[model samples]
Structures are given as structure tokens and as C-alpha cells.
Target: MDNQYYCNRCDREFQNFNAIKSHYSDSHKKTLHYACSTCYQCFETEAALATHRRNNPGAAPHQREPKAT
Candidate 1:
């Protein structure tokens, strides 16, 4: 359908950007907002960024881990 949006990465179709973005973030582990300040890189989630920081300590300021409430 012309109104449907197609995801090239996953070959999935969505009704809108929000749906596609959500699908991409979950299925592809891609970031919609969170980013690395030093390299201007983005991650799918905070945990992914944390992993990156652990692997690359010299890259940028580390993002604080979420505190358990």
C-alpha cells in the first residue's frame, strides 16, 4: 500500500514513523535519541551505550547507570 511505510533493514511494514521507529529500536537495537557526546554516535538504548563506554573508556564521559528505585 502507498500509505504503508516499509523498513529496508528488516523488510517490515508499518503504518507510521512512530510504529517503524519503535520496531527498529526493538528489533534492530537502534537508537532514536540517546547519543554519544564525544563521537556524536547514537545507541538503541542506555545499556548499549554503557557497553560502548565500558569497551571504549577514553571515548567520552560515561553515562550514569540508572539507579534502582
Candidate 2:
């Protein structure tokens, strides 16, 4: 049997050896697109932003969550 590894962060799937390797380098290894100015925390997607907001009550609600992975 073969195994598969998926990136929850990027929501990408890999079936074979090379695809998984490329996915990690191309998606996971890159810097986050969204950043928290107050804490300088970086988030790869908007969903992460919402998760952070839940912990930060003072945060604005207008912030958007990244597309589902």
C-alpha cells in the first residue's frame, strides 16, 4: 500500500513522492501572506486570522478567514 500526506495549511494533496516534496517547498516553505501588525505574527491564510481574532477580542470583525483547506 502507498501513503499520502496532505498539507492542512495549504489544503493541497499529494499522491506520489515528488508531488508531496514539491507541495511542501512551494506552499509550506513560503512566508505567510497575512500579518498581525500588533504582534508581528504572520498567517498563511485568512482562516488563521479568524482563529487569532477569537483569542483577541479587541480585534476587528471585518477580518476575513482564508478559504477552507
Candidate 3:
């Protein structure tokens, strides 16, 4: 069986865990900018933002992709 590693911080796909960890540590060791407009809350992934929006009736979270710097 093969495992696939997906990085939400950098929006990257990796085949190995070690490589993804190194890439994440080097490239995305910063704040994620996927903020919620209603409460100005930040989240690490879009799925988290979506879950937040779903939980909050009036959230209306922004659908922006955060670029790693």
C-alpha cells in the first residue's frame, strides 16, 4: 500500500511523509491567511474554514487560497 501526503499549507501534493514535512517546515512555516470575514479568524486549511462556516450561520468565510511565502 502507498500513502499520499497532501499539504494544505502550501497546497502541494507529496508522495512521502518526510519530504512533505521538510517542505512544510521550510516553505510554510508562517501564518495561514485563510481568514473569516465575519470574525476575522484564521484557519490552517480550507476544510477547517468550511467547517467553521458550516457551524456558524453567518460566517460567510472567504474562499481564498493562501499562498506560502
TM-score between candidate 1 and the true structure: 0.43
What tens digits encode model 1's per-residue C-alpha lDDT throughout 1-69?
Answer: 444645546667776545656776788876344444444334456776677678788886745323222
lDDT per prediction? 0.56, 0.50, 0.59
The true-versus-predicted C-alpha distance at residue 35 of model 1, in Å, is 0.3
- Sum up the clashes in candidate 3: 0
Residues 1-69 of candidate 2 have per-residue lDDT tens digits of: 234434446555456434544555576674344444333344556777568767887864443323223
lDDT of 3 by residue, 1-69 (tens): 244556655567666545565566678774453555555445566778788788898755365644445
TM-score of each: 0.43, 0.40, 0.45
Ranking by TM-score: 3, 1, 2
Clash-forming residue pairs, model 2: 46-65, 46-66, 47-66
- Cα lDDT over the full model 1: 0.56
- In every candidate, how many clashes are there? 1, 3, 0
- For every candidate in turn, the CA RMSD to the true structure comes to 9.5, 12.0, 10.5
Which has the higher lDDT value, candidate number 1 or candidate number 2?
A: 1
Query: lDDT rank, highest first?
Result: 3, 1, 2
